[model samples]
Target: MTSKSERLKDEGSRLQVTAAGATAGLISRFVIAPLDVVKIRLQLQTHPLSDPLTHRDLHGGPIYKGTLPTIRHILRSEGLTGLWKGNVPAELLYVCHNAIQFASYRQATVFLHSTLGEGTIPPSAESFIAGAVAGGTATAATYPLDLLRTRFAAQGNDRVYANLREAVLRIGREEGFQGYFRGLGPGLAQIIPFMGVFFAVYETLRPHLTHLELPFSTGGALAGTIASVTAKSATFPLDLVRKRIQVQGPTRNQYVHKNIPEYRGTMSTARAIVQNEGFRGLYRGLTVSLIKAAPASAVTMWTYERALRFYISLGERSVL
Candidate 1:
């Protein structure tokens, strides 16, 4: 039904979208990587970060405290490289995830607008569904890398599985294939709605904020902050659960978790945290997450849009 030129144009558009997503992920990953390391350590910790006494792991290892102190401890102990632990896997995970997410979202949007929602459903609802599908697809496709990243970040100086290659092989041999998907259920449950709200809020706010002409994209920053914080606040507990679950493999003893409960499922994990550590346990590293993710979200979306515009403009210039 479409001309050759139209088909080519569509392909180019998809490529541009994916490229933009990849660029955004690559750039933003470097921006908040250390903070992400901090988040994971906090998430995997079983005790209150507010405790005055340094909590000890089951192995009597020093459990990390609040963000700054934790950062200091890591630097004092593991050197600067500690902040970027798991960075390789984290980088790959983000690039692949953003590319898939944006590409799938574009396809889903087109499909819904032209086919499913044609003359029927509202655009807002379509955005919600499309965003959900996009996040879920990206998460499922790149889950192994994510699991690896979490595992690497959750550890301190006492490394487990050495590097990425060893981590993959040992996890495969020891825990089996299911080890790769250990936290996938909670991850998906969190990401699906998390991204749904994310895109919905972003789409709603971007137009208004981008046009405000505020210096350094204050509006865009505001929108991104609001979106990330709002969405994360709701799904953050599952994120913690996933981190806990991922480390429950054979190498579980490698890290310090202070007798962390073996969470059977998402709900059980939530219940265990509530019973043991109180409601606040669900939000251990939340401060750093909000600080890191909020700005990273803003930068990512802004960069993605800028990349998209740059690519599209180049395409147009070539055409002209």
Candidate 2:
């Protein structure tokens, strides 16, 4: 049985972790918004032509064959603000998503530690399990915002969304309530393994890097970068499928086409991509995605760790 003071302390710690996670997520999303826009554009590119949607001239040869070309084209056509098209929803999603994730992760870790005992399981395994739970919980809570953000980011100037409310109401009216959860199956699937691998790898490598006498932030950043890259590479295909499903609707917005077969579910989406575009289709935006993930993960984890430490210090002082 825990004392009242101990329970209060634990609650304080959890709230602090949640705040740290939200701050980290907001800053990281803002830093990488441009790359995020580019990655979505690349992922939404299903045809091999200079489609107005993706701004890619697949037939224009080598110069247009990569991420840099895509970036240059977005800059030329839409200017700087274009890169942050969905920033509002993106920022909101991150704040809620990551706050829930880190808070749940800590709580889950506590439960697991108590149930399984500290020495009963390896720390890496414990972290992986806790991360999966946290990721799933967070994704379920904020998935609708995620879908809206993806659609907004992938949209061209063809349609104008006055605000987030308009977009939500439109999607609901057009696609039904299910529209909000469009890619939920694949999103949930991707996040579980994605977070499992991320936390496992981060926990495993962080201690080793810290032993090298690196600054705490530097060590956390490096570990996060490596973990994110690895997890993202492994789950890129699932992510692509989730994005595709999220953007499919009745609207003539970018990425949706009547000619293309509508995906019924996760496996169907995978089959469609593979059958139509080959295995490479699943990896379409992989390069830009990796570029975005590395720095975003670094900044997020570094900030999270630092903020968590600061909060913990404050708690300790208060307790004393």
Candidate 3:
């Protein structure tokens, strides 16, 4: 019989959680990468698909009007490999991001329980703060990979830098070190609250999820879908802005899209999107994003939970 303590982990030390998270991220990044590429292509397109004038724009059309259409366009235009456009840098980013985020989250949770408990802040509030800290730290640490991934996925027939190494070296040599972090401000803006609510919602639902007695995989999937949809929806605009900013600066000329705008900052980027494309522009790729987010998060959490269980069981045996 599974003991009460075994139903959910007490969370584990920072190192164990980190390893599990890295494993989870590596697996999920591969699974959801095609959807991720489709989403980025849709998000980075400045022209509104709703506009009939979209036909005039270089990369615009009904090409980006929906998720399936965008995928088809990429496949037709850029081939099968296009779907996995940025997988190289993306792998590094996802692995490091999850490792650091989960480790920090575990540490933050412990810190909260020791210092504050449920006395001052609520448990959900503690989760929110911990998630924000974890997301911000991970996003910042692995941001260059993120920027590189975005650039790689954002390109079409025209190439920017031949490979990951060329892109990194060119950005460093040409745009300087700051080039690696072009959109970091908005990235943190998007992630902090996105993850804050992601954890808050997951932790909030977890007790209830346990009560349902679903199998581990099914329950994790349900929880991940709910948390991911809610959080991704709330902060998606900033995500759009971040991708747009990353493609700007010294190398703008090489893109297939001729008229991409350069914005001053986050608000500026957002304002331009809204003013030109209207409110719907802020959520350009939301459908595909939610689609990608669900499986990615579900796989990540399911894998992490299983790994945590294994680690805990191993520890127990070692003690015996």
The window of 10 residues in a row where model 2 has the poorest summed lDDT is: 55-64
> How does model 3 fare in lDDT?
0.84
TM agreement with the true structure for every prediction: 0.91, 0.88, 0.91
> Over the stretch 1-320, how does candidate 1's per-residue lDDT look in tens digits?
77423543454498899999999999999889999999988888776444566744445556776789989988998899989998999999999999999999888877776675453665567768889999999999999999999888877677886889999999999989998999899999999999998888887877787667666666776787788898898889888888888889667767745456677788888898988888999988989999997768978988887888898888889999
Tens digit per residue, CA lDDT, model 3, 80-183: 99899989999999999999999988777767766875347877888899999999999999999999999998777778879988998899999998999999
| Per-structure clash totals for the candidates | 0, 0, 0
Distance from true position, residue 142, model 3, in Å? 0.9
Model 2 residue 214 distance off true place after TM-score fit, in angstroms: 6.2
Which stretches in model 3 have alpha-carbon errors above 4 Å?
1-10, 53-63, 211-217, 315-320
Each candidate's lDDT (Cα)? 0.84, 0.81, 0.84
Greater lDDT among 1 and 2 belongs to 1
For candidate 3, the 10 contiguous residues with the lowest summed lDDT are 54-63
Model 1 CA deviation exceeding 4 Å by range: 1-12, 48-52, 55-58, 256-258, 317-320
Candidate 2 local lDDT, 1-320, one digit each (tens): 78423553555477898999999999999999999988887777666333344433343211224788877867776688878989999999999999999999888887876787754777788889989999999999999989988877866555446679999888888889998999999999999999999999998998887545454458768889999999999999999999888877775343322233467799989988887777888898899899999889989998888887788888889989
Clashing pairs in 3: none
